[model samples]
Target chain A: MTLVKVYVTYKESILDPQGEAIETAIHGMGHNDINGVRMGKYFEINFTDDAKDIDTEIDTICDKLLANPNMETYRYEIVNAEGAK
Target chain B: MTLVKVYVTYKESILDPQGEAIETAIHGMGHNDINGVRMGKYFEINFTDDAKDIDTEIDTICDKLLANPNMETYRYEIVNAEGAK
Candidate 1:
């Protein structure tokens, strides 16, 4: 089995209201040192595959569903469970 | 510096539209075995400190800023650079 982790976040140029809200809350709670906060999405996926073109298949997943390429960007890491042993 | 990683996600009872969409797309693209998908949030925070009540402080950050305890659940790990040695 292959376990993949995906992280999706807004492009740097896009404003993140959730991150901004967290930033304000942090500052309000007397933690004035924090300058900014950026929020992102994470996923854990398990698939049974031992194929060479796995990255391409996962990229297709990202392109079709995991992210909106215009506003969000995604990055992923694949783990080979058997190889780790 | 204290490095913290936070993962926030909806409680299991809550339906995840994003995850459901991904599941449908995966099956539609001919990978039919995937049964479910759950998505969450991840954050990496860096702070400078060496304090015993660091977890409490970070919890405070989570309570007041990083997470919504009512609708979301959170878990965090603290990394101590000095302790690794």
Candidate 2:
């Protein structure tokens, strides 16, 4: 089995309202040291042992369901489950 | 400057409806190879150069706004922005 971590974030061109809201809250909290924030989605996928051609499989999944290519970009990292034991 | 990546995920005890939805969708697409999934929120917090005691700052922020500790658990890593340049 493998554990894949996928992170999807909006492109630089898009306006991230949530990120802006957090930035405003930070300023209100008097934490002016934080100039910006960007919010995103993270997924922890448990891929069963039988899954094959893993890289291609994940790519298709990301393209089809995990990310909206028009606005967001995604990247993922896979880890061997056995190594954690 | 520093970049802090905060990952907040549902505690193992809680039911993750969003994750379950994705898992069901995966199965519907004929990818029965995945048995489980957990969804999480990812944040990219950009700390200005003047920020101080970053660890404590982030800790407070996470406890107060970034997560509902009763339902979610969070972990973060601080990285030197300069190092990535």
Candidate 3:
């Protein structure tokens, strides 16, 4: 089986309010050395050994479903299923 | 500066309805080779060089805010901030 690890995050130009809120909360908790924080989505996808055109499939999936083209960007890594947790 | 990448996910015994729904959608889109999918949270945090006991602080933050200890688990990696995007 193949395992794909995908991360989707807001574009650099976008303002991440949620991340800002978390950063404030963290600061309130006394971690003042933190400079910034960004939050994103993570996904683990497992494919059967018979799956074909896996690379193309992953890109299609990310563009069409996993990320918003206007505000977010995504990247992924493919690895043997056995190597992932 | 320091960069910390954090990944938080549901515990093995937890039911991930969102992931299952996405998997169904993917299959409906003709990606029948997919076996399963799991969804999680990702974070990128930047800290100044003066941050003290970062490992301990990260543990505290994850336990108190980033994850629900009963249902989720988290892991992180630290690297030079300049190396991250």
Please tell me which predicted candidate would have the highest DockQ against the true structure.
Answer: 3
* lDDT, candidate 3, at B37: 96
TM-score of the A chain in candidate 3? Answer: 0.94
Query: Per-prediction TM-score, please?
Result: 0.72, 0.94, 0.96
lDDT of 1 by residue, A1-85 (tens): 6677788888989998987887777778877545456688888676765445668877988888888999999998876766321
- Segments of candidate 3 deviating more than 4 angstroms: none
The prediction achieving the highest TM-score against the true structure is 3
What range of 10 consecutive residues in model 1 chain B has the weakest lDDT sum? B45-54
lDDT of 3 at A18: 87
User: Per-residue lDDT of B12-80 in model 2, one digit per residue for the tens?
Assistant: 989999999999987887787887888999999989888878999999888988899899999998988
Find the candidate with the highest lDDT and give its number. Answer: 3
Ranking by DockQ: 3, 2, 1
Give the CA lDDT, 0 to 100, for residue A13 in model 3: 99
Which regions in candidate 2 have their CA more than 4 angstroms from the true location?
A83-85, B83-85
The root-mean-square deviation over C-alpha atoms between each candidate and the true structure, in angstroms, is: 4.6, 1.6, 1.2
Q: Fnat for model 3?
A: 0.93
Candidate 1: true interface contacts recovered:
0.36
The residue-by-residue lDDT of candidate 2 on A1-85, one tens digit each, is: 7888899999989999998998888778878889788899999888888888778877888898989999999999888886221
Native contact fraction (fnat) of model 2: 0.86
